[model samples]
Target chain A: MTLLAGHPTKVGRLAFVDQDYPIVLPVNFRVHRGSVVFRSDTGSKYMAAAMGQKVAFEVDDVDEAWQEGWSVLIQGMCHEITDPHQLKLIDGIGLNAWAGANMHTLEILHHRITGRRIV
Target chain B: MTLLAGHPTKVGRLAFVDQDYPIVLPVNFRVHRGSVVFRSDTGSKYMAAAMGQKVAFEVDDVDEAWQEGWSVLIQGMCHEITDPHQLKLIDGIGLNAWAGANMHTLEILHHRITGRRIV
Candidate 1:
């Protein structure tokens, strides 16, 4: 979660299978209670989450010149936060989607989190 | 391809279906003849490529302060460059995996490429 918080871009890629092929999309996200929280319209992402699909969220920082970096991968089942209480709570967390408005909240229930750091 | 070249980190996330779940792993890569090329050992990635699985590779640049960025997504079939001639040609392209030794060459045969930029 600290890595997610400290990412300079505050951006990560959300990976999920769509139409029999894996797809990764860049999303502005926040870490909430050890899970990844982000907003999106009722698009493919929301649909995927609604289906409780397993996903991988990845964030990394690399120094090209030095050839060193650290990466964190979170593998979990995605759930659309539909409960009113949870939705209100997440709204108060101050995570706004980088694009679009009236977005739906989605969370990746972190099942396995791993990190690799190279120096 | 231009975005891949100009990315400061020269890194991107490779997404593929692994064990019924989507997994995304960060990889150091370079563009060669409009395809993303990188090196890897006989790991899950190399195995996935050897199977010719469909994959998604994503790269992005974001400015937290300005709340803007551009993202490129490449949907393709992963292929291990087993042909010695192609391997030699890609080796000459000068992309080294960020870590490890005696890596195998992998390429994503471009099927579809898309990008979005928010200014």
Candidate 2:
């Protein structure tokens, strides 16, 4: 899948099933090659990463008045990045960490990365 | 645990662990009592529901320049609303389904609904 060009300017949203119901959240992300990466501290997202499963990422912009906007969806498998060497590489890229939490632990998940661009 | 007051005009984001990494998505939602609800078609979110697990839901608003906004986070167990009776109740509430897809099946999942409001 193609990463949206020019600094990947899109909001990242994630949807996963929790006990038969769906829970969704929005995140800031940086896309590279074939993986989508973001940072997180000890939380539910961390717990899910510990479980190891496939997940969904959706990004979109909509204007209610115009009834128009574009959305990009990425569906793939993700794996956490734990190797210190890899972590350092991610940090080197200098992505904006806007979550305002200490994500020093740095978990990187990669999705198979298929996307649909809808306008 | 409390639902954000008044029609819950916040963006819903879901974060889940996929194969040792975290994936996040943004969604539209309605909150009532102690649960958060939304609709979906057959997708990854549906698969996660079928697995029966807890998930995370985050809602926030941020104005970059002001560096200020409020975020509400809900972490809990979710169960799909499969019973026809409950399904009808959800439809009756008339929450706006803005996803623009045929969510006629109406799968409702309830989170334990704990939230932190950060401004």
Candidate 3:
């Protein structure tokens, strides 16, 4: 699929699968270059990144009244950023740690990204 | 946390984060030992597993009138089961592939498990 000229302009849901079941979370995001990025603590997302695995990122805008919606799907690799300076940069950019544990302060890392838009 | 005597009896949502946005998917799952397992095809979950990352598996029950809910959170590593024998075994278990693409026939892999229950 050809890349859109800018980040997707709608909010969407993301689903990650383990076994046959899917774990879903809601998110607000932006796409830069060809990669999709988001932030989280030492929770599930962190675990996925640590394993150096490719993940599915999805965004959708659905209108139940009209039963119509558009979605974007992202398939890519996850990377955890451990560099203290980078972590500081992420923190500086207003990515707050809302996770309920002290273990959430780890630095923001970049994810190796690739994906396509499904309209 | 202590292991529960049996699999969790409720359904939950799983979330994976990239950059600062979260990708969420709803799932039905079970806990065996310390791992949570489910099934999906060559879509998002497969991508995450290919990266060998840890993912979050969450299940919840909520009562809108009471505004109460209990959530179970799982953290673990994802491994793709590429063994043809294992693939056949998983396919034999009635795990039907429903993804909208032909690339979804990859075998079911086992996920390394860990998690906690929050009532």
User: Each model's TM-score?
Assistant: 0.87, 0.56, 0.37
Q: What lDDT score is found at residue A57 in candidate 1?
A: 88
Model 1, residue A91: distance off in Å is 3.9
User: Ten consecutive residues with minimal summed lDDT in candidate 2 chain A?
Assistant: A1-10
Q: Give the per-residue lDDT digits (tens) of candidate 2, residues B1-119.
A: 24343434434665555553345544456664446676655555543643344567776664433434555556655456677876677677655444555353322254455443334
lDDT of candidate 1 over B1-119, digit per residue (tens): 98898787778889887776677888889888778988886664435543578899888887756778888889988876788888888788678787767457788898889888978
Against the reference, the lDDT scores of all candidates come to 0.79, 0.52, 0.42
Which CAPRI quality tier does the interface of model 3 achieve? incorrect
**Model 3 Cα lDDT, one tens digit per residue, B1-119:** 12322323323344555453444454334343334444554556545543454456554433323323344455554555556765565555443222333233321133433343223
TM-score: model 1 vs. ground truth? 0.87
**Which regions of candidate 2 are displaced past 4 Å?**
A1-10, A14-26, A40-56, A64-94, A101-109, A117-119, B1-11, B14-26, B32-34, B41-56, B64-67, B75-94, B101-111, B117-119
lDDT assessment of candidate 2: 0.52
Which candidate do you rate higher for lDDT, 2 or 3? 2
- For each of the candidates, what fraction of the native contacts does it recover? 0.66, 0.25, 0.12
lDDT tens digits by residue: candidate 1, A1-119: 99888777768888887776677878888777767888886664434543578888888887767878888888888777788988888888778776656457888898888888978
How do the residues A3-109 of candidate 3 rate in per-residue lDDT, one tens digit apiece?
A: 32232332333454545444544333334333444455455554454345445565443332332434445555455556677556555544322223323332113
C-alpha RMSD for every candidate: 2.4, 5.8, 10.2
Considering every candidate listed, which one attains the maximal lDDT? 1
Model 1 root-mean-square deviation: 2.4
